[model samples]
Target: MIRMYGIKNCDTIKKARKWLEQHQLNYQFIDYRQDGLTAEQLAVFSQQLGWQNLLNTRGTTYRALPAESRNNLTESLALDLMLQQPAMIKRPLLQRNDTFILGFSAETYQQLLED
Candidate 1:
């Protein structure tokens, strides 16, 4: 089954969901805020996409962090922050079987469909 992970209210998540539905693709939306994410799950995503790709540096959650926490971030630090606030992780992390996709983009989605 395809599982999409992100906050329900996120615009990117909305777009991803809409695209999936419009394409008639079956997916399960997992809202980070309401559903909550486990450390193991975070680790799996981090491993699949790398902590850098998984981290959302442009988001408010990341910006609101202390300078010390944000500066010179390590994979360990990034994982900690993501565990504290899943929103700090990138949106619409699409997981299908062993494959993992980070963020949303129409062209990328199209490629995924093609694959």
Candidate 2:
């Protein structure tokens, strides 16, 4: 089963979901704010896709953090921040089996899903 993780109102997530639907691909959507994210699940994502890659440093949630919390960030600190606020994680985290595709790109999705 393919699972998509992100906030419902995010434009990127909306686009990704539309792409999936247009392609007639079935997926399970997990809205972090509504469904809740677990520490274990976050750890697994971090392990598979590096903490830095999973973290959304450009998002308002991360930028709004104090300089002390945002600067010189360690893996543990980043992961903790992401866990506390799932919005701090990158959007449209698509999971298929053990493989994860972070963010959305039509070309990338087509290639990955075709494999």
Candidate 3:
């Protein structure tokens, strides 16, 4: 089963969901706010995509962090922030079996799912 994880109100997540629906693909949507995230799950994603890739530095959550927290960040620090605020993680994290995708893009999604 394909699972898409993100917050419900995020524009990127909305677009990804629309794309999936338009393509008639079956997917399970996991809302971080509603479903909550676990350390084990974050670790799994980090292992698959690296902590840097999984972290959403462009988001307000990251911006609101102290400068010391953002600069020269370590995986441990990133994980702690992400655990405290799931929104700190990138949106539209797609999972299928052992494969995991960190963000949304029509071209990437098409290529990944077309196979």
Candidate 4:
């Protein structure tokens, strides 16, 4: 089963959920806002997906950060910050077994389901 982590209100997450439902794929939706994350979890995600991919630079949370807070951030610091503020995570993180994917599109989801 796919374990999906994301905020409930994000458009990208909505698209991912719709795609899964359309494909009859079973998934567990974890609302990051409600459930939250730990620094260790974020670190693990960074290792798998990379901080560059995990960070939501386009999101308001990221853009609203102080310049100094945003600058000179190492991967460990970024992971810790993301854990403190789950809104900093990219949307629609889908995990199966240990394989993880961020974001969604019909074609990519179709390929994943087939695999």
Expressed as tens digits, the lDDT of each residue in 1-115 for candidate 4 is: 8989999999899888988888788899989888877677777788899998999999998999999989978887888778888999998898888888888877877777778
Which candidate gets the maximum lDDT versus the true structure?
2
- What is candidate 2's local distance difference test score? 0.93
- Candidates in order, TM-scores: namely 0.94, 0.96, 0.95, 0.93
- Residue 31 accuracy (lDDT) in model 4: 90
Best by the TM-score measure: 2
Residue pairs in clash, model 2: none
Q: Give the clash count for each candidate.
A: 0, 0, 0, 0
Q: Cα lDDT of all candidates, in order?
A: 0.90, 0.93, 0.91, 0.86
The alpha-carbon lDDT assigned to residue 113 of candidate 2 equals 84
Sorted by TM-score (best first), the order is: 2, 3, 1, 4
What local lDDT does model 2 show for residue 103? Answer: 98
Worst 10 residues of 3 by lDDT: 106-115
- Local accuracy of candidate 3 as per-residue lDDT tens digits, 12-110: 999999999999999999998999889999999999999999899998889998998789799998998898899899988999778888889999888
Per-residue lDDT value at 22 in model 3:
99
Among all windows of 10 consecutive residues in model 1, the one with the lowest summed lDDT is: 106-115
Question: How would you encode candidate 1's per-residue C-alpha lDDT over 68-114 as one tens digit per residue?
Answer: 97887999988998999888989889988888889899898788777
Could you give the C-alpha RMSD of every candidate to the true structure, in order shown?
1.1, 0.8, 1.0, 1.1
Candidate 3: what lDDT? 0.91
Output the TM-score of candidate 2. Answer: 0.96
lDDT score at residue 95, model 4, on the 0-100 scale = 88
